[model samples]
Target: MHEKTIAELAAALQAREVSSVELTEHYLRRIETLDDALNGYITVTAEQALEAARAADEARAQGRAGPLTGVPVAHKDIFCTEGVRTSCGSRMLDNFVAPYDAGVVERFKAAGCPVLGKTNMDEFAMGSSNETSYYGPVKNPWDTERVPGGSSGGSAAVVAARLAPGATGTDTGGSIRQPAALTGITGLKPTYGRVSRWGMVAFASSLDQGGPMARTAEDCALLLNVMAGFDRRDSTSLERPGEDFTTALDRPVKGLRVGLPKPFFGEGMAPAVARVLEEAIDHYRGLGVEFREVDLPNAGLAVPAYYVVAPAECSSNLARFDGVRYGYRCEDPRDLLDLYTRSRGEGFGAEVQRRIMVGTYALSAGYFDAYYLKAQKIRRLIADDFARAFQEVDVLLGPTTPDTAFRLGEKTDDPVSMYLSDIYTIAVNLAGLPGMSLPAGLADGLPVGMQLIGNYFDEARLLGMAHQYQMGTEWHRMAPGGFN
Candidate 1:
């Protein structure tokens, strides 16, 4: 049951072979046994889960279940849940429990999915590695010594280890896809406005978008059907019609034009990772998917621009964590200055503090135009590069990360190196485009992901391609040796 995909669980529920309550209990028990070592969950809502599962069971008995009814899924701790601690992986919000559910949580509950837990993440969604979490780092399922990527590391690790069938993740820079890549799971980061941000803690507002993470792209599609929609509360939320993401899973990829951006395959990429991507492109070619050469000249500038823009937005977005409102306050303070500085100093971890400082500096009066404004202009150029590539191809293909999962503390010392881990994924966010990562191949006995970027609102096509690849390969089905 642990190895079964979310889609498989849904089918079992529909067939009456399993009850939602039973499924939810199974996952809860697994969390108890396995999560202590992984440190994946920050909060486990046992009572709420039981209640939700009971309701799903009742709905299933009445034959009123949705496709995802009764499936247990985890949520990233960053998403607010009424009466549940939504810490955003920061000590500042260690005691902050929201009064309302996040848009994603509401959607999942409405679809009759049971909550498994709130997974850990990078503090304020600020790091490429989960080490920035106030709770602690989430261990990679593949190799416990290696890190599960951030800021969705816990979510990715849970799904990869079969702790939950699927989980929700947010991507601002490569949060969703990078961790999924490292952990051997599939994840999607939709277009900028596709998923509502209401109740989801903001990191870099303009670049933030939430999506699904699962063992297979088909499951991601099923989850996305419920996850994507219009919400008035989120001003940036798209006012587009709902989509059936699973509709085209069986669609043929014959004659599909796959664009291979030369820059993504250039120097600095690990030879093993480059080989895997080359193999993936060849596999696509065998499926009659055509490959074309495309150049994203400004691709190299993505990391620098993202560093400036993401931190600047994060600085502004995180200012709300003052001691006055909900979240951690100083034990005692002599004055207002003491209150502000002490609360923040104790509340934020080293990495979170670093990003806040960098963001604040970039947006400061003297540096705003030089750093923030220039980064924004460069962001436009990156988007333009994608625009030109999409004009020639239906989808773009590349390695999700430069390498597989690294040892837990490998890059923690050098912030610049840590920032570069998101080099491939940040560009998609900068362009406001939809991107999905599928298990491409393996390197060093660990999984590597192949990323597919599509034009805005082209999630369906991306899923279709991923589904086709999964059908022809078994990469997504493989889990860690101990877990299996």
Candidate 2:
């Protein structure tokens, strides 16, 4: 039961082969048994999950169930859940229990999917490696000693380890796709405004977009159908009509034009990872997919540009967490200035502080034009490059990361190198385009992911292409040894 995909589990629930309670308990047990080593989840809502499962079973018996009636799923800690802790993987919010459900959480509830718990993530979604998480870094299920890419590492790890069938994740730069690639899972980041940001903890507001993480594109499609909807509370939410993301899963990829950016194939990529990518391209070519070489001249500037733009936005959004209203507070205040300084200093981790300082400096009066404005200009150039490529090709393809998951603590000492871990993915966020990562193959026994970038609001086409490729390969089905 734990091994079934969301679609398979939905079918079993509809067939009455298993009750929602039984399915929920199966996962709860697995999480209880296996999660100690992985630290994938920050909180386990067993009581609430069981109650929700019972209600779903009752709804099914009365023939009032939805398509995802009994599916069990986990939420990234960044999302607010009413009466549950939404830590955002920080000490500041460790004791902060949300008073309301995030927009995505509400949608999943409406679809009758039981929430298993909240998963761990980087401190305020600021790190590439999950090591900055206050709860503890999430270990990759594939190799326990290695890191699972962040800040969606916990979400990706849970699904990869089969603790949950699917989970919600937010992508600021490469949070979803990078971790998915490292852990051998399917992750999608929809176009910027396609999903609501209401109740999701802010992390670079302009770049953060929540999406789905699961084992297959079909499962991600089902989750996306529920997650992608407009919410009046979120000003950034798109007012577009609802979409059935699964509609294009079986669409043929014959004659589909795939663009391979020359910059992504240049120096810096590991030879093993490049080999796996080449093999995936060969497989796609055999499927009648057409490949074309393209150039993203400014793509090399994505990392430096993202560091400025994202931190600037994060500085503005995170201003609400000062010692006044809620969240962690320092001991008896010496004064207003001391209260503010000590509270924040004690609440946030080192990485979060580093970003806050960098952002403050960039947005400072003397440096605004020099740093923030320049980064925004570079951002436009990157977007224009993607626009040009899209005019010539249907989709852009590249390696998700420079290499497979690295060992924990390998790059934590060098923040520059850590930031570059997202070199291939940050530009998509800058352009506000939809991007996805699908398991292509293994390199040195570690999973490698192929990124698929689509035109604005073209998630369906990306899912269609990934699903078609998955149908011809079993890479997505591979699991960690002990987990299987």
Candidate 3:
């Protein structure tokens, strides 16, 4: 049961081979026995999951089951689940309980998927490694001593370790794809505004977009069908009609044009990861796909620009967390100023504070034009570069991260080095493009992933291409030793 994909599980449920209650109990037991070492989940809602599963079983008995009925999944802690603790992996909101479900949560519940629990994440989705999470770092399932990439590391780890068939994740500059790359799973980040963000704790409003993570692209498609929809409450939500993300899964790749970014193939990429990506490209080539080299002239500036834009938005979004309202507060305050200062200082972790300070400084009166404005201009250049490249190619291909998963604590002390971990993925968010990472192969026993970027609203093509590649390789089928 643990080894099956969501589609397979759904098929079994339809066939009456197993009950939703049985499937739910199976995963709950796995969490109880294996999650201590991984620390992949912040809260496990076993009772709620069982109750949902029971309802699903009744629906199935009544012949009203949906495609995803009874499928169990975990939500990234950043998404609010009414009556459940949506901590966002921060001490600041450790005691916070949402009064309503996030738009993504409501959609999944409507689809009949059981909510497993909320997975751990970087504090307010601020870090590259899961080490910055308030509930301690999530360990990579492949090697316990290695780090799982963040801020969606917990979601990636849970899916990679088979703790859940699928999970929800947000990518504000590679949180979903980076972790998915390191952990050897399929993760997707839809075009900005393609998915609703209401009730999802803001990290950076412009960059934060929720998507799906799972062992295979097919599973990701199934999950995205429920997650992508417009919500009137979220101003950024796209008003496009609903889509069947899996519609193109079986599309032929013959004559498909794939663009390889010259910048991505240059320096900073590990030789092993590069070699694996080349092999994957060759596999695609054999399928009659044509590859061409393209240039993203401003790609080099993406990191600095993202740091500025993301943090600035984060500063504005997180301003609502002052002790006067909700979330954590100091036990005693001498004055109003003391209450705000102490509550935030004591509640937020070092990384969160670092980003907030950087963001606040960037948005400050004197530096706003010099820093923030310039960064936004550079962001436009990056988006324009992708726009130009897409005119010649159907999709862009590259390595997901510069390297495979690093050992835990290897880059923690050097913030610059840590930030560079996402060097390959940040530009996609800057451009609001649809992107995905699929397992390519293993290098030194750790997984390597190949990334695919598509034009705006081109997710079906991205998922279809990834699914085709997965059909020709066994990388997505490989699981961590003990977990399987």
Candidate 4:
């Protein structure tokens, strides 16, 4: 029962083969027994989860349950849950319990999905590795010595370990997809504005988008159906017509053209990782899918522009965390400046400070026009490159990360090496296109993922393609050895 996918669990619930309470307890016990080592959860709301499960059982009795009525899912700590500590992996918000639910949380509750708890993240969603998390790094279930790629590391780890069947994660420059690739799970980051960001603590507003993470693309589609919708509370939420991401999961991939960008497969990619990706493409070709050589001319520049633009936006978005607001404050204050400096310095972790400083420097008076403005212009070019490539193919494909999970502290001292891990994924965010990472194969006994990028608002098509492949292969069914 614990090893079942969310869709399988839903079927079990619909047939009364298992009660929501039983499912909830099954996971609660898993978390209690397994979480000590992974450190995936920051706050486990046992009482709240059981109460919601009981309510779901009552709804089932009344014949009013929805598709996800009895499912248990967790949120990345970045999303504000009414009474839970919505710490965005920062000590500043360590004591700050949100007074309201994030738009995503309300929707999940409205659909009768049980809230498990808040999962850990990189402080303010700032790092590629999970090491930036103040709560401590989340361990990769595959090799406990390796990191669960982050800033949504905790979400990826828990879902991989079966702490929850599915979970929510946010991606601002590969935060979600990279983790999914490393942790060997399926995760999606919808086109910007597809998911409401209201009540989701902001990191880089232009790049932040939340979506679902699960063991299979089909399950991801089911979760995305509920996750995506317009909300008046989120000024940036897309007002477009609703979509049913799962409707096309069984659609045939025959004749669909997949574009392989030249730069993505070029220099610096690991040989073992490259071979696995080639095998994946060959497998897709066996499915009758055609491939083309496409060039994203500006794809190679995503890192530099992302560094400038994301931080500039973050510097502005994070200004609200001063001592006076709802988060952590100085223990004592001599004056306003002292209070501000002490609170900020005491609360933020080292990587968070690094990004904040980098952002601040980029946005400073003389540098803004030179750095921030130039980066935004390059961003437009990056988006243009993707738009042009889509005209030549149905979806774009590539490796999700350069390598599998690295051991803890391997790249912590060198930030550039850490940032480069997102080389293949950051462009998707810069283009504001929907992207997903599916477990394609293994490299050196560690998971290697194949990333799919679809045209804007083409999440359904992407999921369909991923689902088709998952049906044809067993990669998605494989989990960390001891997790079962």
TM-score of 4: 0.99
How big is the positional error of residue 263 in model 3, measured in Å on the Cα after superposition? 0.1
Task: Assess candidate 3 and give its TM-score to the true structure.
Answer: 0.99
Clashing pairs in model 4? none
Runs of candidate 4 exceeding 4 Å displacement? none
The TM-scores of all predictions, comma-separated, are 0.99, 0.99, 0.99, 0.99
Model 2: how large is the Cα RMSD against the reference? 0.6
Clashes of 2: 0
Report lDDT (CA) for all predictions.
Answer: 0.92, 0.95, 0.95, 0.92
The window of 10 residues in a row where model 3 has the poorest summed lDDT is 317-326
lDDT of 1: 0.92
Better of 1 and 2 by TM-score: 2
lDDT by residue for model 1 (331-417), tens:
878899888888888998888788889999999989999999999999999999999998999999998999999898899999999
Off by over 4 Å in 2: none
Task: Kindly report the root-mean-square deviation of model 3 from the true structure over all alpha carbons.
Answer: 0.6
User: Cα deviation in Å at residue 480, candidate 3?
Assistant: 0.6
In candidate 1, the residue pairs with backbone N, CA or C atoms under 3 Å apart (3 or more residues apart, or in different chains) clash, namely none
Q: Write the per-residue lDDT of candidate 2 for residues 400-452, one digit (tens) a residue.
A: 99999999999999999999999999999999999999999999889999999
